[model samples]
Every structure is written in structure tokens, then in C-alpha cells.
Target: MTTLVRGRGWARTHPLAVDAVLASAVLVCMVVGSFAEPNGEHGPTWGTRTPDAPSLVLMTLGALALVFRRRAPWSVLAATCAASIVELLTGQPRAPVVMCAVIALFTVAARTDRSTTWRIGLVTMTGLTGVAMLSGGPLPWYAQENLGIFAWTGMAAAAGDAVRSRRAFVDAIRERAERAERTREEEARRRVAEERLRIARDLHDVVAHHIALVNVQAGVAAHVMDKRPDQAKEALSHVRDASRSALNELRATVGLLRQTGDPEAPTEPAPGLHRLDELVDTFRNAGLPVEVALGQVGLDLAAAVDLAAFRIIQEALTNVQKHAGPAAKAEVSVVRVGPNVEVTVIDDGPGDDKGDEQRDVEQHTGGGHGLIGMRERVTALGGSCSAGPRYGGGFRVHAILPVTTAKGGTA
Candidate 1:
């Protein structure tokens, strides 16, 4: 099998040489057939006759024409057919020169279209049989030789057409398999990119919010450490609480990536709107008065929608506490009406005076993904989000999350 594979590879690389080999094979078969007389004594007799000079020349000429069959199938077929006609008409004892024409006809049929093959094959078969019948030898018009020519030529055309059809079918199947493989690879890459973006958003939301609180409390402790020990100790305690909360959230976020059998994996469910009061108390402890209005009560929101609502509120209040001046107040409201839940956060404080007002991709300069993360989360759920400076003053973020998400589930 390996040797056959190697020979096939060589034949493909040297197609002209393969054609030459086929021509040689056809020549040998014609020469051997010419020495046998089928109508002689017993049914068929070998080595009973030798081809005459003209018959030998016609046979050689027809075989040589096949060497160029692949390059010019029609031209070679015409030459071989002409040689066969000459042997049939003039040669005293005919040689089987038509063998070369049969091979050439097969090549023509395989290379050309079916309509061309049928027309050309019919012409060759009828032309050769007519010439042999009209030759007026001792044998009658409807001899076995004439019938053999018609049958062989017809079969060659059919066989070549079959080969061509099978080759085209195999090629089409191969191309479709390759296309499907490429599509699968592209889909895998798209899913991986979406997963990476989600994990990064989670890390950013968890870290940025708690770190902002920790920064505020630590700064307060440093400011009053010398004069007010009790107040400084209280400030330090807030910092400690913020740090622990940050650790737990961080653990939760990172735990999503841990393998099932890994040790010390957190079993707690992810945070959602149920913890809105705790989120508010954290900011209030940092000296930012955040008032919450929850009109989405008793609404059985999807897990994803609930988590997004909680993060939107958390990030908005964090921005107010961090970027808005110390005396600023924030109001967070989540109201559900008519197949949608609207989350709005409005702050009376000036939002980073001389900062990013339009709230585009770059929300601020502190490496924070403030409005960017919020917009991405809302948009993924097929909802609309907007953040900009309110007409008079301050910043306002409003998002309408659909109760029924794009994935065909209610939030």
C-alpha cells in the first residue's frame, strides 16, 4: 500500500511521464493483439499472423498520438481515429490500431463536458464503423470488427464520464468539510473573547468599588490621627471592613475560574440586588449620604439581570463617593414598569469638574471603567444605557433593563 501511494504521488507530480507510460502500455497491447486471429481455427488463435508493413505503421502512429492525449485530447483523438480508418480501408490484413483510439476517446470524454463527449464519441464510433464496413474486404459489411469498434468506443466514453463525475463529487465533499472546520474554529474564538471580556469586567467592578472606599477611609484616618484618636480608630475600622469586603468579593470573582476539585472554593452565590442595603451602608460609612429607592420589589429577576442591577448601583455610588466632592449626595432608584426595569443614579455634586463629561469608552483618568462597564453590561442584556452631565449640574446615569432579556428569559 505504501509503495502504491508513493507511485501515485510520483504520477501526479509527473503527469506527462504517466501519459507516456500509458501510451507504451497501449502500444504493447495493440502489438500483442495483432498477432492473434479471433476467427481462425479454434475460437481464437495467438501467434498465427503477423501485421503487414502499412498496418504496423498505422498502429505505431495511433499509439504515438496518445502520448499527447492529456495535453490535446481532441487533437489526439482525431489523429488516432484517422489512423484506424486508414488501417481499416487500405491494409490487406488489419491490425488493432483502434485500441489507441479507444484510450484517446476515454481521455477526451474525461476532460471535456458531457455534451461534447457524447457528440465527439458518436462521431468517432459511427465514423470508424462506417469506414470499416465500406472497405469491401472478403468479410461482409457487418463484421465482428465493425461491431467491436462501436462497442469499445461507446464503453470508453461511458467509463470516462463515470470517472469524471466521481472526482467532482469527492472534491465538492472535501471543500465542504474544510469550510465547516473553519467555521467551527471561528465560533470557538468568538466565544473565548466574550468570556475573557466578562471576567475582566467582573474583576474591574469588584476591585474598583471597594478600593475606592478603602482609599477614602485610609485618608480620613491619616488626617485625624494626631488630634482625634477615637475618630482615627473608627476610620481605621472602616478601612479594615472595606479591605475584608474587597477580599471576599475578589475571592468570589476569582473562584469562578477554579476547577471543580480545587480546594477552598467559595460555595456562596454571586451578589445581586438583594444586597442593595449593604451596598448603601458601606458608602454611608464612608461619609457619602446615598439614598436608595427600590420600586422593583417582588420582581423575580433573572440571575444575570439582578447581578447587573447590583453592580450598576454599586459602581455609580462608588463614583459619587470618589469623584464627587466630600459633601455630595447620591440618589439610586430602580423602578420596573411595562416589561422594563429602569435604574437611575443621580448625584447633586459636580462630577469630576473638567473631566470626561460625555462618558464614552474612557470614563476617567484613574484607570477606572466607570460608565464603560455599566454600558457593556446593560447592552449585553439587550438594554439601553445612558450617562451624561445633567442639564443644570452633576452627573446622571440611567439604564432601562428589559424584564425579558435577549436570551428569551425574564430578569
Candidate 2:
């Protein structure tokens, strides 16, 4: 069975060679049938008594036309049918001349639509059978030979139409499979792009916050180096701590890109609302007096919500430190109200017209991306974030996140 399948595959790939082989076989049949006698004494007969030169030539021409059957099936069928009619009209003994016309008709039906098959098949069958019956030959009109021609032509048309239908079905299946594969590839690419953007936002928030603190501490250390050695030492220590925290967070953020088979990466849990105290302490050490107010309504927050709330607070404080004057103070508040956690950071800095415009220009001109990152994180979790200068004299950053997990479970 396997060998037969391989042979058919090879024949499809080399159509010209298969056609040549078929033409040769048909020629051999016609040549041998011409030499046989149409008598009951012989093993079998096709109503032919003796071979004639014109009949032999016509039979050879009809057999040779099968070579081009695939390329021009209608033309080949016409040529073979005309040759067979000529043999019939000349009153020559019957040979296998009509077999070539049957093969050509089948080729046409297999390659064309059903409507063309029905029309051409009817014409070929009726023409050949009518000629065989009406022409004056040694056989009678009601002979079995004429009936065999009609049956054979009808069966060939039916078989060829079946082959065409199967071929169309296989083609449709192959096209659908290819379309599905392309859709899967596109979906995978879209997911990869979203993940990369999320990682980029995390990296930006981590680097901007810690580096601002490092710059402030390093300046304090350089200023008090000679006059107050102890104070300078404390500031240098804070700088070192800030740099170390920055490196740790950067490593964690980049570890997401590591291959699964590589060495295991850091498993430290991400900073969340629970780490609010530590976060505030770091900002206080950087010389920003920040007060925290917490109000609770008893709701467990999801991990993503907890992380987003913490990062929002962190970024808001960082912006206050960078843009507000030296004497400015900030307040951090976290309140839970009916299935939601709201985080608000407000700074009592003199946000005058000049300061607001300066900060706006800096944010728009790429000097800051903290607020943008915060808003994106909040919005992804189906929350809302707003940041702007307060009406009186300070800046406010507010974000509200859902406390429920994404899987419809209470965290």
C-alpha cells in the first residue's frame, strides 16, 4: 500500500512521463487488436476481420492524441472522436479506436466543472454510439458491441467527476489549515509585544525613582565632606544603600527575559503595599518629610493591585522630590472603600504657574515618564489614575484599583 501511494505521488510530480506511458500502452492495444480476426473461432473478437492501411493509420492517430489530454482535454477528445468516426464511415473492421476517445472524455470531466462534464459527456457518448449503430458494418445495430460503448462512456464520466470532487475537498481543507496556522503565529507575536512593553515600564519606574535619591544623597555627601565628617559619612552610606536597591530591582526586572532552562533567577517577591513603611523611610532619608495616613474597610487586595498601588505612591513621591522646592512636605494616604483600594499622594509644595509649566515641559519632553507608567499600570488592571496640580498650591496623584483578583476570586 505504501509503495502504491509513493508511485502515485511520483506520477503526479512527473505528469509528462505518465502521459507518455499511457499513450504507449494505448498504442500497443490498438496495434494488437487490429491483427486479430473477428470470428467465433478466435478466443475473442471486436467485430473486425482484417486490418486495412487507412484504419490502422486512423487508430494510431487516435491513440497518439492521448499524450496531450491533460493540457487540452477538449481538443484531444475532439481529435480522437473525429478519427474514430472516419474509421466507422469507411466501413473498416472495428478496432480499439474508440478507447482513446473514452480516455480523453474522462480527462475533460476530471479537470472541468460538472456542467461542462455533463454537456461534453453527453455529446461524446451520443455521437460515438449513434455512429456505430447507424453506419453499415458487419455487425447489426442491436449488437452487444454498440451497447458496450454507451455503458463504458457513461461510467468514465461518472468516475472522472468523482475524482474532481475529491480533489476540491482536499484543497479546501489544506487552505483552511494554512489560514489557522497564520492566525496562531500572529497571536503569539502580539502577546510577546505586550509583555515586552510591561517590562519596559517596570524598568523605567525602578531606575527613575532610585537614581533620583542617589543623586540627592551624593550631593549631600560631597557638600559636607570637610566641615562635617560624620554627617558626610551618613549621606555616603545612604547613597550606597540607594545604589544597591536600584541594582537589585533592575536585576529582577531583567530576569523576566531569561530562558527557562538557564540558571534559576531571583525569587524575591515584588514590593507591594506591605512595604509602604520601608518606601517612606527611604524618601524621608532623602530629606522629604512625608506623613502616611491609612484608613481600612477590610478588603483583601490582589497581588497586582497591591503592586500597582505601591508603585504609584513611589512614583508620586519621587516626582515631588524632583520638582517641588526643598521645604515641601508630602502626604501619602491609602483607603479601602467597598471592593476598591484608592491611593492618593499630595505634596504641599508651592506649585506656582512657573513650576507647573516647567514640570509639564519636562514630562512632555522625555525628562519624566513616571506618571505615564503609573497610569498604564493602573489602567491595565481595570482602574483609573489622575495626576495634576491641585487647585490651591500643591500637586496630587490619585489611583483607584480593584481589590478582587482577575479570576473572580476575592484576594
Candidate 3:
């Protein structure tokens, strides 16, 4: 089987050479058959008589025409048919030269459409058989030799048509398989891009929120280190706790990128609104006095909605701590309305106006700032989030998230 496959591959690469070899084989068959007498004592007798000079010449021309069958199927078929008809009319005993014509007809049928194959096939079969019969041979018009021409020509057309159909079917299947594989690869690439963006968002939210708190507490510790050691020690303790929490969250976020063969990571679920009290406590410890109001516990919300809600609140309060001036007080409210949960963070600190204008530009232009992240998280959940300066003073961030997301599941 392997050898046969290699031979077929080589034949495909060198088509004219393959046709030359096939023409040689058909010539040998015609020559050998011409030497056999149709009637004998037991069966047909071979070597009793040989093809005459005209018969041999016609056979050679017919076989030679087949060498270019694939290149010009119609021309080759016409040439072979002319040679066969001439030999049938002039030669005493027909030299089976029509075998080359049969092979040419098969090539035409396999290469051309069915309609052309049928039209040309009928013409070739009728023309050869009619000529063979019309020629004044010793045998009758309905002899097996004359009838064999009709039979072999018809069978060749049918067989070639079958080969053409099977080849078309195999080509179509291969094209569909290639298209499906490309679609799967494109889908994989799209999924990878989405995962990378989500991981970046998680990292930004985690780092921005905790680092801001650490910076604030470290500054407070340094300000009163000599004058008020007790207060400074408390501030340093808050800094240590913030750093540790940041490390743990960073590990969980980065672990998502680990391969299967790597060491096992912590299996804890992602943070969501369930950790709201804990999130509020972190900011309170950073010298930012925060007041919290909860209308209804949103612990039963969908996982994505819950996570979006938590991150929005975390980002809003962090912004208030970073952008809103010191001695600023913040109010955080989480209210579960019908079919939705509303989160609003309003700070009374006098926010810098120039910086707020720049943030507005960045937010509109798809910046990676905290407000942009907040809006992106909300938008991904099909919700709306707005952050801007309030009427009289500080900034406010508000987001209304759906209770059940498109791909909803409890956290």
C-alpha cells in the first residue's frame, strides 16, 4: 500500500510521463491481441497470425495520441478515433486499435462535464461500431467484435464519470475540513485575547486599591514617627496588613495563567460583594473614614454581577482616597432594587478639577485609569456606571448592575 501511494504521488507530479507509460502499456495489449485468432480448436489461438503493416501503423498512431490525452482530451480522442476507423476500413482483420480510443474517451469523460462526456461518448461509440459493421468483413454486422466496441465505450464513460464524482466528493470534504479548522483556530485566538484583558482588569483593581492604601498609611507612619510613636506603630501595622492582602490577591489572579503541570494554586473563589464589609474595613484602616449603608444583602447575586459590584465599590473608594483630599469623608451604599443592584460611592472631599478633566478625557478615549476600569467592568455586565464631580463638592461614582448576568451563576 505504501509503495502504491508513493507511485501515485510520483505519477501526479509527472503527469505527461505517467501518460507516456500508460500509452506504452495499451500499445503492448493491442499488439498482443492482434496476433490471436478469435476462433480456434479449444479457445482463441495466439501467434496464429500477426497484424499487417497498416494495422500496426494505425495502432502505433492511436497509442501515441493517448500520450497527450490529459493535455488535449478532445484532440487525442479525435486522433485515436480517426486511426481506429481507418484501420477498421482498410485492414483485413481489425487490430483492436479501438482500445486506445476507449482509453481516450475515458480520459475525456473524467476531465470534462457529464453532458459533453455523453455527447462525445455516443458519437465515438456509434461512429466506431457503425464503421466496423459497415466495413465488408467476413463476420456479420452483429458480431461480438463489432458489439464489443459499443460495450467497452459505454462502460468507459460510466466508469470515468464515477471516478470524477468520487474525486469531487473527496475535494469538497477536504475544503470543508480546512475551513472548520481555521474557524476553530480563530475562536481560540479570540478567547485568549478576552482572557488576557480580564486578567489585566483584575490585576489593576487589586494593585490600585491596596497600593493606594499602603501609600497613605506609610506616609502617616512617617509623619509622626518621633512625636507619636503609638499612632505611627498602628499606621505601620495597617501598612503590613495591606501588603499581605495585596500579595494573596495577586497570587490568586496570577495563578489563573498557570499550566496544568504546575503546582496546585489556592482554590478559593474570587472576591465579590460577600467581601464588602472586609473591603470597607481596609479603607477605614487607611485613615479614610467611610460610612456604609446596605439596603439588602446582594450575596445571592450572579457571580459576574457580584464581582463587578465588588470591584466597582473597591475602585470608587480607592479613587476617593487617592484623588479626594485628606480629611474627606466617603459614603458607600449598596441597595438591591428590583432585578438589579445599585452601588454608589460619594465623597465630600474637594477633588482637583484639572485632574478630573484629564480623567474625563482618558475615560472617553478608553484609558486604563481606575474610572475607565470601573466603567468597563460595568459595561461588560450590560450595566451603566458614571463617575464625576457632585453638584457642590467632591466626586461620586455610581453603577447599577444586573442581579442576574447573561451567564449567571452564584458565587
Candidate 4:
């Protein structure tokens, strides 16, 4: 197989040399056959026993025409056929000159479509056979020479057509395999990108939610250090708790990216709507007044929708704590309306002109990626989220997630 591949590569790179070798082989065959006659001594006495100078010249021209067979198949066939016809008309005995025409005919069939092969093959077969049977010696119409020419030319055409068909089949299979490979590569890339985006969203939610609480508590500890030492110590303790929780959550999030075979990572389930109370308490301890209201809704929500809802609420309250000032109060509500579950987080903070300006500056400096991440998560799960300033004051974030019906109940 290796040798065959190398030979094909060499032939493609040095086509003229390959053609020269073929021309040499054909010249040798014709030269050797010129000295021999058909039917031994029992043949009818007709044309010259040996090839004359003209016959030799015709034979050489026909054989040499094959060197350009691949470059111009039809032209090569025409030249070889013309030389053979001249030999036939001049009463030359059966010789290997016809072999060159047969080779040329095969090249034409191999290179061209089946329709062209049929037309040219038929013309060459009929013309050469007719000439051999009628113009030459006193051989009969059914003579072996004429029949042999007919059979050889027909076989050449059929063989060449077969080669052409096989080549086309191989080429088509190769093309389809390449296309499939390319499609698989593109699909793999798309999956990797989606996985990276999901990890990014998870990291953002973990860091923003926990770090925001830590920041607020640390500020409280600093503000009360002189006047109220007891409250300052309490605040510092809350900051420690918040930081520990953040580290744990960050570890869990990072663990998700580890190899499946690794045994050191945590196996805890991801945070979802069930963790709403814990999430609310974290912000409450950070000194932001938070109220939670849960409506009648099934607990069997799909994991993805539940996680998205939880993250959206988490991010909204984080934004409130950051932008709504220390005097802000936040309200969170989860309710079921028809086939969807709605989550709303609203802050009754100062949304005055000065607050709006600061918020705008924060947003411009890349503080708004939390909202964008929330929207992306909701949209991915066939849900919708909207966030903006409220009518009178403060900001509100609302999201609705579809409850898909499952085998046992709605999910």
C-alpha cells in the first residue's frame, strides 16, 4: 500500500516522465511484433510479409501519440487511429500498430464521460474492423484478425470506463468523509464554547453574591470600630462567615471543572430555589433589610430553570446591596402564574438623580455584567427577564420561567 501510494504521488508529480515510459513500452511492443506474422506459415499470401519503411513510420507515429494521451485523450486517439488506417490501406500485414490505437481509445474512455466513451469507442471499433475485413488481404469477414481488433477495442473501452467509475466513486466517498469530519469539529467547538459560557455565569454568580455581602459587612465593621466595639466585632465575625461561604462556593464551582475521575472534589448538589432562605439570610446579615414571599408552586422544577431563577434573584439582590445604598430595603417574591413561575426582586432604595448618575457610572465601568448574565441564563432556559428602575424609586428585576410538564408532574 505504501509503495502504491508513493508510485501514484510520483506519477502525478512527473507525468511527462511516466508518459515517456509508456511510449517506450508501446514502441518496443510494436517493433517486436512487426517481424512476426499471424497464423504461422498457413496464412494466406496477401500483404507484405514484413513491415516496410512506411509501415514502420506509421507504427512509430501511432505508438508515440500515446505519450500525450492524458494531456489530450481525444487528439491522441485520433492520431493513433489515423496511422492505423494508413497502414491498413497500404496493405500492411497485421501488426502491433493497432495496439497503440487501442491504448489511445482506452485513455479517451477513462478520461471522458460514458456518453463520449460510447460514441468514440463505437466509431473506432466499427471503422478499424471494417477496414481490416475489407481493404487488406483476402481474409474473410469473420477472420480472426478483424474479430480480434473488434474485441480488443471493445474491451479497452469497457475497462477504461470501469476505471473511471471506480475513481469517481472513491472521490465522492472521500469528499463525504471530509465533510463529516469538518462538521464534527465544528460541533465540538460549539459545545466547548457553550460549556465555557455556563462556567463563566456560575463563577460570576458565586463571586458577586458572596463578595458583595463580605464587602458590606467589612464596611460595617470599619464604621463601628470606635463607637460600638461589640457591633464591630459582630460585623467582623459576619465578614469571616461570608468569606468562608464564598471560599466553599468557589471551591465547588471550580470542582465542577475538574476531571470526572478526580475524587477530591465536592459532590454536593448545586444551589437552587430550595436555598432561597439561606441566600436571603446572607444579605440580611450584611445589613440590608430583605423580605421573602413564596407563593404556591410545585417544587419539582427542572434543575436548569431552578438554578437560573436562583441566580437571577441572587444577582438582583446583590445589585440592590451595591447600588441602593446602606438605607435600602429589598423585597423578593416567587409566585406561580398559569404555566410559569415568576420571580421578582424590588428595592425601595434611593433612586434619586444622584443615585442614577452613580449607577450609570458603575454600569459604564463594567458593573452590569451581572444583569447580562442573568438574562442569558433565563433566555437559554426558554424564560424571560426584565430589569430597570421602578416608577417612583429604586430598581426591580422580574423573571418568568416556563414549567414544563414531565412524567409525574410539572418540572
Between candidates 2 and 3, the one scoring higher on TM-score is: 3
lDDT of each: 0.85, 0.84, 0.88, 0.85
Per-residue accuracy of model 1 over 283-379 as CA lDDT, tens digit each: 9989999888899444579887888888988888877776668778999999987888889999888656534343422444324476778888999
RMSD of each: 2.9, 3.8, 2.8, 3.4
What shift in Å separates residue 182 of candidate 3 from its native position after superposition?
Answer: 2.4
Deviation from native of the Cα of residue 187 in model 3, angstroms: 2.6
TM-score of 2: 0.82
Which candidate, 1 or 2, has the higher TM-score?
Answer: 1
Cα RMSD (Å) between model 2 and the true structure? 3.8
Per-residue lDDT of candidate 2, residues 63-116 (tens digit): 788989988888999999999888777845677688888898899999999999
CA lDDT for candidate 1: 0.85
Cα lDDT of model 2 overall? 0.84
In candidate 2, which residue ranges exceed 4 Å CA deviation?
A: 1-14, 34-43, 46-48, 88-91, 136-142, 293-299, 336-340, 351-368, 403-410
The number of clashing residue pairs in each candidate reads 2, 0, 0, 0
| Cα lDDT, model 4, residue 356 | 69
Candidate 3 — worst ten consecutive residues by lDDT sum? 359-368
